[model samples]
Target: MATRKVKRLYRSDVRQARRLLRGHTRKTPVFHTDILGPRGPVPVTLKLEYLQHGGTFKVRGCLNALLQTRGDKTGVVLASAGNAGIAAALASALRGMSCTVVVPESASHTKVAAMWSHGAEVLWHGTTYAEAHKYARQLAAERGAMPLHAYDLPEIVTGAGVVGLEIEEQVRGRPPVLVAVGGGGLVAGVAVALGLRGRVIGVEPEGAPTLHAALAAGHPVDVDVSSVASDALGANRIGDIAMEVAQRYGVRSLLVSDDAIVMAREYLWREFRIVVEPAGATAVAAIQSGAYVPAPGERPVIVLCGANTDLATL
Candidate 1:
């Protein structure tokens, strides 16, 4: 069988997106802390992507894809579990384009409202992300609108790779990066940016291990999804581009329980006054639960990627 030609997102691609998004996106700084460095005196750096425009790292990819592909009067369509929908809506609004977002019934109400607030025509579809994705594609086809993928598209992942570039330049010691995986876009992009220089740990909720299952199967495979983080980290299957990047770069996948996720979220609030959604707390959950322990002297960097949560619940 002939091997499929996978278009890789190189470091140059990431740099290009970073340059393009300079004036539009926020350059979130690293917050150094000793809270998770409990194993010893090692420092822990948190890349506060939750402070980004549209309140998540999803904005980076959404904006980049729209910026690169949008034409005058171009309409866009996308399916998201939650955060990606809001990002797409915000990106479209910024670019002065019309957007329609199809979201799963399981999506958070706050996220759906945010998408609507950004001038997107929001539609409720199936109960899972995969189902919504199928309907979204059909809607795009019917309406002759440009279809935007939540994670699989090269432009999106390439934009996400910019986060890794920022992390490398912003952090003092170029520490290992720990990121939560949903459809695996963020980790794959980070893998491309960091390459072999630093370890990229891909964290996931125990209830929804899409990347983990894919890595175990040696390919992208559908998995059952259910967890506190499902609204954000609930892709039925890992994206092909993401799997290729992860395997090529030797990105490590780790899983943490939902309880650990709650604990991590609470810890962030207690220590840093940071309010993060469940998916945003997955990386910290791995450390807090010892799922991915830092070495004696290794400095681990965690990317808190979203804040579009119902703060009242927290």
Candidate 2:
């Protein structure tokens, strides 16, 4: 496996990245809310990233990586559960680079179709994202293609930090917590951007507690992969870089039930008119299930990460 020392992104890195993404991605809204307030006395702000380009915040990092690798039209290859593939394909299309995406057999058809629509060659591999990633690496090496890791690169993390940067500016003051966790990229980036400014509580599906398992083992360790949010949050193990950044920033991880994710999805659609995949709603699950209580009068922020879901399921 490839290994590299990953640095925590500074405020200047995020500031420079924003300039790079000016016309490409939106500064998604951070809406202060009381909608889920009946359950607790704390106010909440939802960072609506589902509204971002390519239907998720993945575009920020995808575009950043592509831009950094500019002048290489030989194209890039990547593996993703869904959203990352869509983001990479869209970025490739915009840059006129040939792109291929390896996705797990378990990925939603809607996401697969979106990749095709963006002119990306989609290859289905094993039953999970990790398997697809393994194959993608082999294919990239064989084709002399650049590999764009979904969560393990510094550029990707720096790009994702933009979400926290936008939220910090939009929210005015620090929220008590910002909830999100996956293969650890999103939370890691957000934590770095929000470090010492506020607390960031990471929420993962109990079925796919990559970060939790990593923390317990004192390093990135592979965990069982079974979760409704598996397509998006599922990684056999947390990325080594993400783990380092997250641990250094004091990020705490929490687990939520699959039932909570379903309810969170429904809540977002019914109340806020937002459609999100299970992973995207994980942060909301933390709030809905009372997994993390807010301090009185303190604000809580949930990063609504993505919305690439099959409409029929909604």
- Candidate that scores best on TM-score: 1
lDDT of 2 by residue, 1-314 (tens): 11346665775776677778889889998887764633754468889998998888889988988887855457889999888899999999987788899998888888899999999999999997888999999999999888999988877877888888888788867775555666777787787777766677889999999888888877888889888888788788888777886677777888999999999899889987888898888988887788877777777888889888887887
lDDT of each: 0.88, 0.82
lDDT per residue for candidate 1 within 1-314, as digits (tens), equals: 00245797788888899888889889888898766633544467899999998898989998999888845548899999889999999999998889999998888999999998999999999998999999999999999898999998888998888899989888866578999999988998888888877689899998889889888888888899989999999998888899988888888899999999999998899888999999999999888777877777777999999999998878
The alpha-carbon lDDT assigned to residue 168 of candidate 1 equals 88
Candidate 1: global Cα-lDDT? 0.88
State TM-scores per candidate: 0.96, 0.95
